[model samples]
Target: MRHFIARGAGLLALVALAGTASAETVLGTPLAPPALNADVTGAVAKHFTDAGGLVFKDLKPSKARGGKGYCGKVATAADAPFVPFQVILEAGAAPSVLLLSDADGASPAISEENATLLLKNAGCLE
Candidate 1:
């Protein structure tokens, strides 16, 4: 019985390690989610006309394209609630702004039919 318990513990440890191994990073550093720095916020703001009022939070490196971009939640104003948003950047290509919606089908501009899939693709969802 002790042998079996030890084996189970080992298996659990391996599973935990595997989960951390697959996490995406912006600067090749594990356990550090990307920050919503000025460059990233600027890149996203350029796509909008009035982004001065926007506030970003919960930023993370995108898993797509081998962690080449960033994803997070943004609030249009201090009084507004935060919404999921993604900015996928590619070399020599304009950044892509993926629209997302909240659980109630509101926020992030509008309710997109593919919001869930987009969120998944952007790594906004687990």
Candidate 2:
């Protein structure tokens, strides 16, 4: 009976420790954007390229909503049918990119399906 009790207590302690470690892993670690727009630009360019779409040639800092984090515009390539896109970067969190369009417009610059695919491919949720 004593041996069984000790084993159960050890198992419970192990489970508690495991839970704490998993929580820390899910909390995420912060990351700083690379200098000269290398990190953000590269990630966006790769996303478009992998999706077989027009690549974003220029990425410049832009206004962000709520002023919470960094935001930028992904400029459209010359003569490309694609409209400009925007991206928001938050430290220790995933970046979000969206196609620009009028609020009243029925059509979005990028379809929701494509946007999700691009983001997933770019590992933006990480």
Best by TM-score: 1
Model 2: residues with Cα > 4 Å off, grouped in runs: 1-36, 49-58, 65-79, 101-126
Q: In the order shown, what is each candidate's alpha-carbon RMSD?
A: 16.5, 19.2
TM-score of 1: 0.56
- List where candidate 1 sits over 4 angstroms from the true fold: 1-36, 101-111
Candidate 1 at 81: error in angstroms?
1.6
Q: Candidate 1 on 15-98: residue-level lDDT in tens? A: 111211111222222224233355556554554445656666677776665465677766656567766666655568545555
CA lDDT for candidate 1? 0.49
Please count the clashing residue pairs in each candidate, in the order shown: 0, 0
